[model samples]
Target: MTPAQTTRRHVLVAIALVWALVCGGLGWATRSAIQLDSFEAREDQRRTDEVRMERALARMEAEIAPVLYPERARPYMHFRSYYIATEARYRSDSSDASRDILVASPLKDYRGPDWILLHFQVSETEGWSSPQLSSEARFALPAGGIPAPVRPREAAPENWFAALQERYTAPMLEQVLMETLIHSGEVEGLSAAGPRPDAAPDAESGVRTAAAESARRAERLLQMQREIHPASTCEPELVAMENLEAGSGQVLYNRETGACVQVYAPLMTPVWLDLTQDGEPMLALVRSASVETSKNCTLQGVLIDWPKLARELTEQVRDIFPEVRLKPLLPSEMAASATVRGRLHTIPAKLVAARSPPVETWGLSSGLIGGLAVAWGATLLALVAITYGATKYLTLAERRMQFVAAVTHELRTPLTSFQLYSDLLAEMPQESAEKRRHYAGILRAEAARLARLVENVLSYSRVEETAPNLRLAPTDPSNILEAAAAATAEPCQKAGKELVIENHCPRETRIETDSQFVVQILTNLVENACKYSADASDRRIWLSAAPGPGGSITFEVDDAGFGVAPKDRRAIFEPFRRGTSEQGRRAGGVGLGLSLSRYWAQSLGGVLQLKRSSRNGAHYSCFSLTLPSAPRQC
Candidate 1:
């Protein structure tokens, strides 16, 4: 095959390869996009699961703890000494499998903000009792936002003591004690003011008697003019003071004295609290399993502030309960079953703190999905990058074609003129002096034109190929302008246009740049201006150089001609582009001159733009070039 055919096949193969690669890359990218989409769905599901769980937790908390505590049942418990007894039972019946009596745990060691001691009394023969050892307890709860109820009027001592005598004094005086000699040694001493048992006096017995009498006397003094004592004939009323509710350990107070002696405690003890099981359980003896008790008269005669105590307890509960589980409903069937089987006990304070779902958890799903999408997007971007680089290779091939075509035409035009003129001068003899001189001038003009064209094409090719690589040299400002003026004089004179040098810059103001490139720029611009003004009799070309800001020099070439239209200014500077060419006017060149000049200017870190124009004979197309100033000599 011929060299031309080989070159064409190579170009065709290269173009086909570029298209094939781009197509394959794009297909791969598309597949990746689909895979990412599928993964995104799974990510969305994961986020949805998380959100559902959070919402369910919020619902559970809302159901369990409402915004406000009920208005009617608020009460505070006051204990002199409170105790909680816990006994593990292998079987349900306490009697079927009995164990030794053990020490009870004190519910709270000392007085806390919620409670205070009121009165206490102990028994000589027994551990403690409320009646024979008369005691009173006080508590405060919300009563229409008031502290407590008004204190009742004190009852007569005789009436209160008489009632206490019938309750306790009758129970202790047993049949054996009334008919036989039931001494203190056999029956122990009775409660003070009840039956006083007669027994022999010994060192140990004397100390016990003195201690019991001291406590009894103290109780009697405090209740001298109060309501019925602990062992009053109104014994039923006394038992009522110890009543308790089933769950929350809240108290009930006496309306008359604003005294709380009864409270609620957990009344059921399970071997294991079944979390999966819903609703209350069915079982016997559960009621008596969690019996609440008061320790000594320490529990009686106590005062409490319910609201303040509730606040403090809330803080304590928050501190103690730190972990929260996802609500069971939010998980998938398998996941939820697993969570339910897992160890779930206490919930975090935040779950129960508010009545609605927290706003912070709102975007839980979107955030997770977004993170996954970002990772997938990174992979997709790599595929797109490969496609972009391959496509750019095709564009480069097209620019190469344009370059070859433009360069060939540029060489051919001037070469043809120079060859024709040189042949005429060579054949003419010295005898035909004036004709020979004319031919010599034509030869010189054509040769110079060829030289300038070659220089422009070569310099512009270099500038375009390696942009920002400017070949700079410091020289006189006039050097470039003088060379351009000399080359363009013939064209200007032919067109009857005056080319003027308006030098505002100092003669010594030098610049660093490729002289050939500068001369080419001025030559093309001045030649274009002259040709465009060929119809005008009084045509003028203004070449000016001035000192610009930042120690730079600006060179401008202006021509009085049919100036460019506003819309065509930007479009005219592109390769193979021309302004709106008019009929009956000198045709513009192939339109590479301005485009090449722009490339040259930019390679030197400068710009070329149309400054201004006019409709009159002084119509101007300005070409300004700027470059860095050289350092001054010492």
Candidate 2:
């Protein structure tokens, strides 16, 4: 190819490459922003979940303790809490999995702080659904807070048992199970596969083995109960609790079933005696069991941290029932549930936990992405100027401006298509009733405005250059006047004003001018009148066409608003010399609207002159256009 042709090809290639790079870079940037936003959103959700979980745990401790140990229970511990643990397992043939939990709470009316509860989903399926009971608690009990640690040993004397007649089995069961699970070797795989043979039991076993298993499971169950119900977060410790001494160890097997039910219900159970000394022995009894699985448990109303109670009991059972080498249930291995409520209705615990949902990050994500994108754009521009010699490279700025113009044209083309199709749809006679009522007439107005914008842009481009060809045709001046008046009427009504078309032209008169040009002239004149007359009490737009000396028409549009100054009169028709602020506010434009309209009339062999500007109610602008009469057919 020749040098000029080569140069042209090079410029085109550069432009194409730059455009592609920018587009792809922008797309990638957008995707990165979105993904980062998602990550941040997940983090926020996790934080929110943690917060809610903490609240729920706290609340449960408060409620359960009050019911189980009234003296220990405070006002906050009035409401009961059921402890739960949930574990999920995938079905063999499906991607989706189901979760099981122990000890679900049935108490639904969560009266808590607004910011913490109302908007969140509290359970596995969001609300209360498919909850597991891990361990049941009687009151809020911290790990190792119970009086007598369960261990293989001779039962406390008959007096100890006599004092513990009111003791219940549910809370003890939950604590035993929880402790066993937590100490299990296969705890890590709780969410996935079951425990290995070394860690868990094999199914087939003789009656003796089964009996042993049952006894072990029972002991473990009680351990889980203790784990579930623990002491409150803020209760003051009693010296008597620390002063109580551990008793001598001995194996006390339950002769009835050969199962060693290690009864840790000590008469001198220091944790209980310390409080009972000051007041009555507040019974922290387990009201129910809602355990679904080990890791997943829900104690309907736990007076203690059932899981922790379970753990403690597992140790206690091990110590007391030495001959039974039983394992504490790993959190994954045992499911136990129980409830604890005050004998009297309103004991409260200072610490309370609330269940709530995750937080949303849409606004944060969007703002972050937007800010980054704007920064990246600026940086990219700087890099381009520095590395690409943009200033010296083949009139880059000019080419860029041209590219913008072309791009705008491309954008406007689609908009034009939208306007046309939408307008047509709006005008469809067979449209649905709902659509007709909702969307009719909206598109046409939008299209007109868009068309006007396109005209203004093109007009500005041509301002310093020779204008485009103005094709003339013999047109009826009266028709052009009427169309302009009709167009202005819509705008006038919207502005709470009025428009009047005074057709004084003789029906016999017609002008031979470009019909488009005549329409343009009348539109401009009407617009000026409206702008200057909007605030006037007698706001009106009058259009009149009369036969002039030779076959021309004198068209006028008059308004009764704030008029223009004499010094600004001639300048208003000049390019960019718009009417002052008052006029501009009433009728906004880039100021080329009138100038272009006037130019179009002149180019079409017609005159467009402002008739008059007045301070009185008769403020108006008029234009007289002259053209040859339409040729008559023989």
Candidate 3:
């Protein structure tokens, strides 16, 4: 190569290196960005899921507010009443003569949430009493200490304290309540008669002193004026306290002094009583918060079915967290369940997502992640495009250098013949006409060789400049084959080979292509066949035209030359590339012959290819030209 060409090649190499480096950096950055974006997206989705879980649990807590603090639903559970009223109503709407009556109570009917198993109450010197017994039956008991209302208040309680027998069979609720009083230490000292399961305390008659005794036990804790004492009849003229709604615990207050006395905590046990249900499950008991007495408790609160209720709560949060768990707090976990307010003893259970929350692959920032991935794809494609362009430019340059060397070698033989024949013709006698005709023939053959070489060189240059100049016209396929036989006839004769044409085209079939290109393409193929197969025993070059696939005309040039080596097949049609066989080495034409033919064929909208085939188990390469067949009428 020239020094200038070498310098140009070095510059191209440097440019390619710089481009590759820049592209590599771009690729790595794109990959990193995509990875980082995916990580951030997953993190964002995880946080969103966590927030969703918290909100769902908060909504659940608000929904089950009444269950957590039952006193909030029935404030009388905190008031000082044995059979506390859940609801109250006035006997008459008339302001003058109106007495308040309890419309609902635990002892009246099991009107609490279904989650609660049962409700029962125990009074001082009185055992357990459920709503299972009618008011008449309860009042008819032998130790009945219940005040039988006289005169105006002596009204039928037929509609009050209806039997709750349907909820619990006889003795089942009664038996559980009796056991509760014993276990809770309430009946031992708080109840004067304790639990009399068979008789039930105050069943028929006894110390109408039960109310007095209960008041005394708790009176010392809340020392106050007689007018404000619970045992004293409530007079509206005395204090200005309003009945609070069920959302807040009921309280007895002296609005005059702004004092709140006996909140809801006293009427219901603040902690679970026999909640674990290790043995005979006990009833819920209410120990007055006003009176700090151990065995000095008063009444029982409602019992709840913990396991079933917990499962239901867990079910509600399953969508947020598939493995969510809602469970009663064990003694050890109870400390954690109670928040900073120092254990108000409302709910002692916990709800939690049992497993780590998962972030879906297709999540919150999926669009961003997808965009980053597209950037990575773009970077890789750009690198591939740059690399391909650089490689193609370098390959074309190498083929040009090879073309220059091959052409120099091609010009050597013809130039030497012209020199030898010119010197002989100048010195030969004027009378030797036979010698002059022979010399003239030899000169014409050599001139023909140079013309063919120049034609190929010019054709290749024209293809490089732009598209080929084509004159399209309808021409018979057989005519093209005959032209190729004539053009390559002299070359074949000199090489001791016969140029044969076989026409297999049906009549009326023609090609719609440039006839000149077709003939020149076939001529190049036949000349290659003669040069490559010069030593073949058959000494024949076959040129044929036939009907090809897809309604096209095919022209094939087949030879028994040395088959192309496996390695050379790929580059055989590449500009300036030649086979490594001994026959190809001896052939002296620039390698642009087949390349130019393919270019021209393609310009005429046809394909030129070396069709691999074996004739009678002997390998022979066939160069085939397939062109579009013209439309013709029968």
Best by TM-score: 3
Worst 10 residues of 2 by lDDT: 117-126
The TM-score of candidate 1 is 0.40
- Which whole-number lDDT from 0 to 100 does residue 219 have in model 1? 37
Residue-level lDDT of model 2, residues 460-542, one tens digit each, is 67866976555556566668866776767776776666666666777666666566656766776676666656777876656
List, residue by residue over 173-223, the lDDT tens digit for candidate 3.
323333333333323332222223434456444454453334454443222
What lDDT tens digits, residue by residue, belong to model 1 across residues 1-634?
9554576577667756765775677667656655666566666755664564455444444432331111011111212133222232445465412123222223234323222211121222232232212333112221222212331122222222222223222113221111111111112233234324767668878976764653443333223212211222111212323321112221122243222233232111111111111221111001010111222111111122222323443444343233332222211132223344221222212223222233332233455457546755764576456556645554455445655765576668677867877787788776988997887777777677677666656655665466544456787778877888897888888878888986787767877677776776778788877766566545788877788998787888776566766677887787655666572123535556888888766656677777675434444366677766752221
lDDT of candidates 1 onward, in order: 0.46, 0.44, 0.56
C-alpha lDDT of residue 127 in model 2: 16
> Model 3 scores what on Cα lDDT?
0.56
Evaluated at residue 490, the lDDT of candidate 1 is 81
Quote the positional error of residue 117 for candidate 3 in Å.
8.4
Q: 136, model 1: CA deviation in Å?
A: 34
Candidate 1, poorest ten consecutive residues by summed lDDT: 281-290
Any idea what lDDT model 1 has?
Answer: 0.46
